[model samples]
Target chain A: MTETVEGLSINLATVRQQWGFAEAVEGCLRHGIHAIAPWRDQIAAIGLDQAARIVREEGLQVTGLCRGGFFPASDAAGRRAAIDDNRRAVEEAAALRADCLVLVVGGLPAGSRDIAGARAMVVEGIAAVLPDAVAAGVPLAIEPLHPMYAADRACVNTLSQALDICDALDPPQTGALGVALDVYHCWWDPELEAQALRAGPKRLMAHHICDWLVPTRDMLTDRGMMGDGVIDLPAIRRMVEAGGFSGPQEVEIFSAEHWWKKPGDEVLATCVERFRTVC
Target chain B: MTETVEGLSINLATVRQQWGFAEAVEGCLRHGIHAIAPWRDQIAAIGLDQAARIVREEGLQVTGLCRGGFFPASDAAGRRAAIDDNRRAVEEAAALRADCLVLVVGGLPAGSRDIAGARAMVVEGIAAVLPDAVAAGVPLAIEPLHPMYAADRACVNTLSQALDICDALDPPQTGALGVALDVYHCWWDPELEAQALRAGPKRLMAHHICDWLVPTRDMLTDRGMMGDGVIDLPAIRRMVEAGGFSGPQEVEIFSAEHWWKKPGDEVLATCVERFRTVC
Candidate 1:
């Protein structure tokens, strides 16, 4: 029963525990979801050419290639290595014809407490990969992670901060650099609305949806489905839409204990139902 | 060995697992720490009069009361109850002659996703208790919890947001309404330095210190000791000091797994050692 659902996408990580690349895509198709965002490892597993072939043949909308950023390092060699890897990610994103190459910029260097230094490295790393991304016709979407992940994941923890990076690098709003707004990471931000408005259509690249569970069991993977947690999804969606992004709202959940243990078919069905009603 | 430490104050919660109010005070005194912050329950357990007597007799500087804010409620009656309780907290602070009545303004109302509404409720609740606080000569210090706790603990999640509330309620930068800056909650903020500068001395009521451990085991009670985590404590202290706040740097740790299970004397010794060296 494949009935196309508009303005809806599934981030493969949501059902990562239940299915592989091919299986997840098949599951999404079964659920009438045509848009998707796939992690680099998943793409690697199926081979990028095969993934691209599948994407092209099925006419699937590759919302984003997740991800390519870990800029900060203890040394210059490590930084250069990260930039080199990001460039490869850009090429893969280009092959997939994705809307953007999501960048979860790295946090503080190993055993280092200097967040400012890490941020500077992120900018430099992005600048290094900008030309490659531009040549490949891929936009770099800086996904600012939640502040809880400031120590290890992504140091860019606010939309304002991400936008500031964009404004600094791509002053003309060329769409080469933008931000991925995830409600799970950004719903609590005081400046969310203002920052969304500031992002506008040109810089607001992607909109990811997931609920913030009240007791959030695991910091890494304890996301709740839409309508299951406390995030005001419609409100955030309104903010993103108002900012000019008319893209599919990508469902990205990383529930290690609950959803991950469920069957892929059930997860997809639930996502579709929730997307239709709550989201 | 009671050589008084001039600028170190202990928030009794660091030793909450091992000692109650009087014993915690005695522990602090033994460590040559003459200042302490006590939770309302701790004060109540020891009888407020007796707690006040101990502070007065021992010449212990009550740095700040542990808390007095949980504004947002599902109903108007609940909000009124919170305000009434805050008034009592003000009286208690006044009796203790503490520096300020720290307010951990609460999060979303049950079954509701209205963060803005919760924040508004916080402001209204604070306003309702402001007159009593002023009359009792107990300054209100709004402590913004980390964004992770924005769901169940506090909706006010940034120094900028807390300051905005203070500014709206008391435009004159009155010492009566201020912010309690905690490194654990705000170390990742990009506007931290700017906000600290903006707070200056008048608006900066309390300075709480603790480390943000990597792989934080529990969101509520897994804080690290001074030198154990990645937080740049000295750098943060420099910012606060530059903001014209020369008050004691109050050590507050909620380590359920590690520090809480240790001996109170060991924790005090480690705190003093870390405060002198790392902080």
Candidate 2:
């Protein structure tokens, strides 16, 4: 049973408002959660070297880096800038010895209606940064956000679409490029099961667990805890495991009105409880 | 130019609060827009008979009826009740001589986690109502709402998924069943163009036009006017046209903060101008 709890990981954004990177690690450790995923902003706050040092000193298992994508832009210069930024993210993930660098590949560029063009840039951006990721021995996990984010946050909005990109870039089922399946984003997809099967072990890199609130008050920040919302966490987790991923199930809730207001220790404890019984 | 205007239609919900059924039709006529789609509430407010008389008297084209779906329920009685209401809606659509009866099929029933079960109910509900729709000579246009509404508004959230339902119920390409292709709902779908082609002339029943705002303020009512958002109106129209749907490009904007507060005539005028210039 403790081994099952050991497989649980906390995404720092779940307690981001309450604690910085180092404090969040301490909080997770107190709750007996040794695995974590941190957002780039959180790492930047403590400085990458300090964050990496803390991870090494604590012997923490870095599940995945929060993000490294947003590739779309209105012009060639902006696209190049995104690619360069992604390369830096690859180096940072490698420095942390993280399992994978997750990508929330961007949506339509500002004042641009070209979703297809944005998607094209996402492919180009990932391809451009693939060499850096390969050199650093860091995997890239394309996190397909829910369809609601299609317009402004991510054009890659399905497991199938993410797999299509992987097939295009790393066709031989290489562990170099893969997907970070977030249940909150994909629980509603009718094709989820089939696509999960298609993703199979090598391509399915990270498994994120969160719930979809019934009356989702806010589009971005109103994510529910594992058992609180409508997602069948065990069911999705079963599919994920069947597809060959045995990594820690990272909890990544972004509830602005409720959970974020709680104390960091309480939040970590609740995550641990939910991870055991519900997840 | 008048011929193009003849192909333009207004969904009365765009100015629903400002005008009743008759007034909205009169407003559409004054704007040189001969076609209009009315919701059930608007139709019932002024009495459907009177609304039908106005449509008949003015020779106004009833492009499509607003809705007729919400089939899932916790109990058998509730499911049966929904089917009965849908039958009544078919009768209403028949009375108005609308080209098709649009179905914004309901989402998950209360406290239900089984989206697949909810989807099965939708298919069964549509099948139950198919005979009445066929009898009334009203085609059932399954409008696949955007995936954001998958939880509460409509489970059928993709053109392909809707077409799959249509295929199951009316396999012969019988005009009795088809899809109401709404750009606002499907513009983000990467497979949209291909699926529109799949819907082709026979099954492409209706084409709905609206823009997706860059920063959509609300999930239900923050829709932009035709050219005000990021949707490539001309591009989607071209796909719909190529798919063999020569129906009016119905402008359905649920802009609570913007257009709905305006006068009905002003809303209709803007619809005309945007329809001409952008759509």
lDDT of 1 at A274: 97
Model 2 lDDT tens row, A1-279: 223257888999999999999899888877788999999999999999999999999899999998899999999999999999999999899999999999999999988888889999999999999988999999999999988899888999999999999999999987999999999899988898889999999989899998988898888999998888888898899889888888999999999999999998888888888888988
lDDT of 1 at A12: 99
lDDT of 2 by residue, B33-146 (tens): 899999999999999899999999988898899899999998999999999999999999999999999999999999888899999999999999999898899999999999
Q: What is the C-alpha RMSD of each candidate to the true structure, in Å?
A: 0.6, 1.6
Error of 2 at B225 (Å): 0.5
The CA lDDT at A164 in model 1 is 98
